[model samples]
Target: MRDTGYSLRNAGCSLLPVRWGLFAVAILILAAPVAASGPTNPPNPTTVILVVGAPGQDEFGRVFAESARLWLQACEKGHAQSIAIG
Candidate 1:
């Protein structure tokens, strides 16, 4: 009598499910190439320059206000000088 135990049942291997999982992962992995091909260069970026005065509590406001007043006085005088020069 032959004892065809459970060893015979496990001898043959099926690659269908493994192949499907690999195919799904392969499809997911291949999208990176398409993404890489699209955008070779990016658009130009915008820039802005801001002059923000300090808040009152930090003593920045007082110094800034004094500097601004001096600048205004100089500008006013500069305008008069320009007119005289012309």
Candidate 2:
């Protein structure tokens, strides 16, 4: 082969800048999701699901019912939707 002064070592050195540029682009692309995932307030009101387990005793049942009522009141004040399940 003619000595054209080109070898594998020099070939890799010449491509160093291109490799670094590709790496930088890849890093930016990977970070895009993380940047876009930042917190933002929703446009609509929130929804709350209030679940009251089985109150085995009469006293427990009254307390559970009272708790549910309080939650419903708070939901109304906040303009949120509340679903209660027993």
Q: Assess every candidate by TM-score.
A: 0.29, 0.49
Return the top candidate by TM-score: 2
Candidate 2: residue pairs that collide: none
For candidate 2, the 10 contiguous residues with the lowest summed lDDT are: 7-16
Candidate 1 per-residue lDDT, tens place, 8-40, comes to: 338786677888999999997999789778966
The Cα RMSD of model 2 versus the native structure comes to 5.9
Which candidate comes out best when scored by lDDT?
Answer: 2
- Residue-level lDDT tens digits of model 2 in 1-86: 68999886777657678899999999999999989999877865689999999999999999999999999999999989999888
Per-residue error (Å), model 1, residue 3: 99
Each candidate: RMSD: 14.9, 5.9
* lDDT, each prediction: 0.59, 0.91
